[model samples]
Target: MSNVVARDIELDFLDHDFEFVGSENVSTIDSTYASQPYWKDVLSRFVKNKGAIIGSICVVLIIFMAIVGVGLNEHTYDSQIIAHQNLAPRVQGLESLGIFDGSEKMTTSSGTVEVNKYVSANGSVTGLEDTYYWFGTDVLGRDIFTRTWMGTRISLYIALVAVLIDMLFGLSYGLISGYFGGAIDNAMQRFAEILNGIPNLVIVTLLIIVLKPGLLTITFSLMITGWIGMSRIARAQVLKLKEQEFILASRTLGARNFFIIFKEILPNIFGQIITNTMFSIPNAIFTEAFLAFIGLGVPAPMASLGSLISEAFKSFTTHPYMIIPPVIVLAILMLSFNMLADGLRDAFDPKMQEM
Candidate 1:
């Protein structure tokens, strides 16, 4: 009787172990796993990449500085004060004309007087006294800090708008050519090749000269040639993706070409698109800046990073501070953007297996 009782207890323990293993297998095979869980895992892996995280933080901080730095400070971008000309940056709570007071003297027909002012240096004050320069005024006697911030806004704006235009046209052209690969594809590709053969800088320069040099013209010239590379990339991606089983399944269901190409394929290729876009932004900015530096971008009274650098170049021997700051900003921006592009490529590539 004791032996039989012991045998029964052993069988009961073995049965409990088997039951736990079966439950584990069932949970593993469950098909309804949430997407949020997958995203959390990806985010965790991404945050672990120190360089990528630092690059991302730099980009965010630069953008925030672009937006809020000017408003928080008292300088007006175009303000010129002869009285406050060429004053150094604040030191130990000492107040100067432009940096601290945010006001300057206005000259009248009779004489000079002061006004309780807002929007400093909006062409309000004239005949700059050329005394006590603050932050080393530009040739126009405008505050350097103010002009720098304004230039940031202009450069960023042009890049964003131009890239958006390129993305729209390039994606459309590439998708159409890739989805219907015959005579149409051949013709479109040949045309793009022709555009590619021409030098982009020459095209931009010619456009600037012909159109008389404005922000819009430079942006337009960039888009015309810029889309070609993106189109090629998109078309290649589409060719590979179109052959997948999921695409075949969608086709079997009688889904239209537009639905298959856009809804099915486009979503899958967004990772590539995002990476390309990030890479393209710096290219656009640099090209625009180079052109402006050469006197072919954004005409006078409108400032850009490149134009600011150009202005600095003229006086670099006299005032090294003027040239160095803009150049540093430009370099940092380009490097941050490139790093970010690389990170996106790593994160988004479906074939890339993370360790």
Candidate 2:
């Protein structure tokens, strides 16, 4: 009987030692809340993305080169050196390290030394004089490197301005139209649709044809249709959000319509607005490049990447390097913007975090 009782009475902590062990492993649950704001969470997530960080760095570098470097450079983009016309790329002491390829031939006193671009007609190769072309000179002897960076700065600025215009008008138009539904929304949307029916490419082309290609002309033309896209996006966001509980609560609290839309609704929709703007930047840039490429860009003496390519295309065989640098820069700028947009989209998406 005693052996059976001992076997049945197994050791167990059915009643924990409340006095000694206390509540080390167990406790009554209490309310908890994060000390940070929602934006802080978003920022934290954005920082975690490696691609976004890299893209941000590249964008900054590009902007810095465009503004700071261009400002500091002594060689103006348009300042021509006719004597140094068609000079191939060369750097001091880096020719042996393959800065200039073997295909690069220059007329030196030593019977046409290959890859020697830093030679003047003094009959003696003094090595890297004023003839030093970092990325070579064009047929007109303009520094290709300087012009390329300048063109980038111009293109980016134009695109940025266009996107800003789109956002300002679009966001306002959309928010108002969406917030006030019924006949107003219907009429506004129909008008937008009618305008949208006409292709933007055709509009810009025709505008340039009429006004002639200049900075102001191109900017005005781009603005004509740019805001329509932004408006549509804004309208959709406002529509989706206007009926939310907070929005209704704001309205019920006697908040003015403007305050409700701008203060209450706009804050929630900032992510989408920014992401859309980022995406539009590339489009605007490509459009500007295309216009410039097809003879509708900035006039001669003012170099643009597209215009440079167009000029270089005529004698590509003679000076192919002239075109390569601009193309590469343009591609990198577009690519970095796209990467940034994607990263922002992913970072802002709550569903992605849950996954």
Candidate 3:
């Protein structure tokens, strides 16, 4: 009778509640049966958020495209298709056999050019029948596909490294300021305020003017100036959490200053820290790109999206391919990053779950 009553009640609840209905027949869900686990509930809610999943997927795909699509698969990014320079993308009918069959000859307008197989376009043969640059070519005729991917690799690298540096310094400074108030806090706050008053772009420009412009210089310029925002965030979090009973209890127990800040205080602020870090990435990437565009980023042979744009700008009137590809890629990267940041902000938002 007890078993029968229990079975009937379970069936009634499952029929009434979507959560119960979804978990039916799953032993793990059955074992809990009444309340959802915190992680499970969070994940369930997250999965329901299509935007977050889409944003995450975009982030993964872009990173993958920036890596394997750009890096390991290609033989030489700098390899010149000397004969196929200025060829429109994927021209058909000019297909030729490779090394084993020997380089085939194509009767182009220029002359009978010896080369590898012509890449295919749509089903129809292109007007550039004898031509075939997969991503077209620049005026000087560097491979667009290679250059774009290379730019992605460089941009992502700079963003990642610069953000890491900002996180460390920002978190440290903020925590110290918030936890140890009075003279130390006053001094650090004043220092940050002074630094923050100076425009970051102007500072970056000055540094480039004084120093040799390269990857390291670009990274250092951003790193040196980027910590202010994150530090302020950290300090604010510390101020809120420091006087709480648990913190006071920990202090009363004679915990070390470092342990109290890192172990006790920092953990509660982890969500904000993560959100701030995510927010910082696109800023760093854009800053680096802007600097490069202004003639202050990585030198040639090491290309960033911004520097690539600068190169493309030189031939915008004649060969737009050089400019178009890099600009499109830069736009996509920036937009995707911003979307991902928004998704992370929502994910970390405590208010959303409370609602």
Count of steric clashes across candidates, in order: 10, 0, 1
lDDT: the better of candidates 1 and 2: 2
Q: Which pairs, if any, clash in model 1? A: 79-121, 82-128, 82-129, 85-132, 85-133, 86-133, 86-134, 87-133, 87-134, 87-135
Query: Once superposed on the true structure, which residue ranges of model 3 sit more than 4 Å away at CA?
Result: 1-42, 71-75, 81-83, 91-131, 350-355
**CA lDDT of 215 in candidate 1?**
81
Model 1's number of clashes is 10
lDDT, candidate 3, residue 189?
95
Over the stretch 300-326, how does candidate 2's per-residue lDDT look in tens digits?
888877898888888685556778888
Q: What RMSD does each model have against the real structure?
A: 10.0, 6.4, 11.9
Q: Write the per-residue lDDT of candidate 1 for residues 1-355, one digit (tens) a residue.
A: 5554444444335544654445646655557855566446556666666767888888788778778866655667766665554333332233443444334345668787654233244667544333322344665667776677677777788668657865898888898899899999999999999998999878877786678788878877867887887888899999999989999999999999999989999988887887888888888889888888988888877777899999979976545557765787788888888887776776665356454
> Of the candidates shown, which would achieve the greatest TM-score relative to the real structure?
2
lDDT of each: 0.74, 0.80, 0.74
Best by lDDT: 2
lDDT of 1 at 32: 88
Q: What is the TM-score of candidate 1?
A: 0.75
Candidate 1, lDDT over the whole model: 0.74
TM-scores for all candidates: the values are 0.75, 0.83, 0.75
